[model samples]
Target: MRNLTVIIPTYNQKDLLERAINSLISKCNDEINIYVLVNNTESNYIVRNKNYANLHVEYLNTNCGFCKAVNYGLRLIKKSRFIFLLNDDTEVINQIDIDNIIHELIEKGNIFSISLKMLKGNYPNLLDDAGDMYTILGWQFKRGNGLPKELYDRPCEIISACGGAAIYNKKILDEIGYFDEDFFAYLEDVDLGLRALMRGYKNLYYPYISVLHVGSATTGGKYNDITIRLTARNSIYVIYKNLPLPLLIINFPFILLGYLIKFIFFAKKGKGKIYISGVLEGLKNLPKFKEKRRENMRKKKISNIKLEWILIKATFEYFHQYIKRAFYTLRGAKK
Candidate 1:
């Protein structure tokens, strides 16, 4: 049985997918199987991997989107102890980084996932993401996004692993369930992380384990109508699915404020309508999340107060970063 299996989900970037696969084949051991989920694409596009023995490809005729594609791939894997979700637009930087992540996973049974650090493609000095962070204000952001790569050199706990490149323990995933298909794409990883947290499992960021990621190769550039709609809609889904009744009511105002701010931001970018539509859609389908809410509530091992504290702390961290950025921007303007 394979100890680790890397799942790469691709939409139409055949070249990028091949590059990713080749990078892994060269850097990783031949024993590590690579499963490529070609979403809405022909399998013939991928050139035969004669050199790599453990490569597998699954072709989907319809565009099932990211969540469903990943879950579909997950369901097929019965032997792997760990599942590494990687984007087609990313390349493994070094085998040692992956080895470190595997070692960490083997050492820690309570860890649900390890989010590998990503350097922006072609700009190796700039950080793409360290890990994912969530706030009570219903905002999810990358922990070390757009910062210097050198700034984040330590491992730490995170709210979620960025789905682009992360290693998840199969056991924890089995216990907490896979990505919520209702999300279709956005914020689904955050929902998974919240479920793990509620079940007393820790998600981590290991900065030493890094990848080179060309962000958003499939969904167009970030802030497109599709991204805006799915993100807006899925944010609501995450909030609804994870929070219990009383906590939801308590955090309602902050969440509303977050949405309001996001609406204004996107409105300035001419995506306000798309954002509102997503939110409305999410609200319309709120009933669909009822079972998820009950499930999380039932399996919740962490105290309500602790969960609130986690969100509150993450919120404070967000504000601190916001203020720091604003200060630096002003300083640069003066310069």
Candidate 2:
């Protein structure tokens, strides 16, 4: 069986898709199968492109959003033991030795996924995402984002792996479950990773494997209405689904504070109303969320304290970054 199957999901970005496909084709060996899910785009667009000749293309008639697109691609592949999820806006920067990585994963038995170092496309010297970090306050952030690349040169455990450029053990995914389609887009990776963690699976951040990502290529660049809405809504779902009832009761205050702070921050960015709308939408779907939460609870293998230990706390550094960003934005506005 082939060791790796790379799944790239694209919405309407044909040019970026071509670049991503070519980069993977050049960097990866022939043993690795690449599947491109052309979601919500006209069939003729892919059919006319000769660039897709070497890659497997699965065309979706309707715009099913990111989560569904990935799940669709996963359904199409059968043989590969490891599945690598890549965003269509990313380019493989180096030749990733799949055999070595697979060996490492096998040796590490508990690791469900390995988060690859994602460098910024515009500034390769800076890091885009080292891995994903989750906090007790029901928030998720990309670790080492905008930091110097050398800062995160060591492998470590992370709360989650970014789906943009992460390798997952296919069996674990089958066990824990695929990305929640209800998420539609943002925070789905965190939701999935958290589920894996609750099921006794670990996620690792491997610095050797890297990719350049042109983030927010599908939705308008970060902090836009669409992204703000989807992310805010999904955040609620993630917290609801993963935390047990007792844990949820204990963390409710922190969760409320987090959402309040986020509302104020996004409001300053002129997305407050949109963000609130998403939050309300999430609350409106509580019945569905509760049902899913019950189902997820059944798969729990770890204690709440153990899971909490893995998550980070709301430290001064976290608030400090936001303060700095707000300061910079105000300064830029004055100029």
Candidate 3:
């Protein structure tokens, strides 16, 4: 079996997709299989181009969101030991240390995944993401977003590896589950990571490997209606699917506060109504996510104390970075 299979999910960005594929072809070993899972795009965009040796394209007629696109690729290449999920808008900036990543996965039996540090395109000092972070408040955020790239150089355990550019141990993923298709687009990685934790597996941040990312190239720069709706709704899905009833009660107030803060923030952006609709949509679908929680309960391996502490640490770090980012913005303004 091939040791690694790379899946790049794309939606309507033909030129950028070419760049991402070429970057991998140049940097990665030709033996590694690369799957370009093309989501709703023109008929001949990918087909017209001459395919490379180890690269394959899977074309879809409908616009399946991130979760389904990735899941489809997983189904196609199920035997690979490690799977790397890369975003079409990203370019591999260095040779992927496949041996090191595989060694780490093998040496550390509990690690489910590893995130690659991503810097903003053309600005090596600016970070796209170090990893994904989750807090007790039901918030999932990108660690070290827009901060100096050097600030997040150390390796550490993260709440989740950003699905955009992370490597997963296919065996563990098969055991826990693939990305939840109900998520459709957002917060799905957090749900997957939480599930991994429940099964006593770690998700890590490995800073030695990196990529150049053009963030939000597919979903329209961060705050669009589509992203807002999906993120708002999926936040509730995350809390519902992972946290048991007791834990949910303990975190309720903080989670509510988080939602309120986000509501006001979106209100300022004229998306308040849209955000509320999304929340209502999530609440409406509670029964399904609750069932999912019950199904996952039997697999819970990590103790309650450790889980809570992980969230508490993430919450404090979130606020710490928030304050530091504000300070940096103020300093920049003064200059």
Which candidate number would show the highest TM-score if scored against the true structure?
Answer: 3
Question: What tens-digit string does per-residue lDDT give for candidate 3 at 127-226?
Answer: 8898898898889888888788889989999989999899999998888889999999988998999999887999999998889998788889889998
Best by lDDT: 3
List TM-scores for all candidates, in order.
Answer: 0.94, 0.91, 0.96
Better of 1 and 3 by lDDT: 3
Residue 209, model 2: lDDT of 75
List residue ranges in candidate 3 displaced over 4 A.
47-51
Angstrom error of the Cα, residue 115, model 2: value is 0.7
Q: Native-vs-model 2 lDDT?
A: 0.84
How many pairs in model 1 have backbone atoms within 3 A of each other, for residues 3 or more apart or on separate chains, i.e. clashes?
0
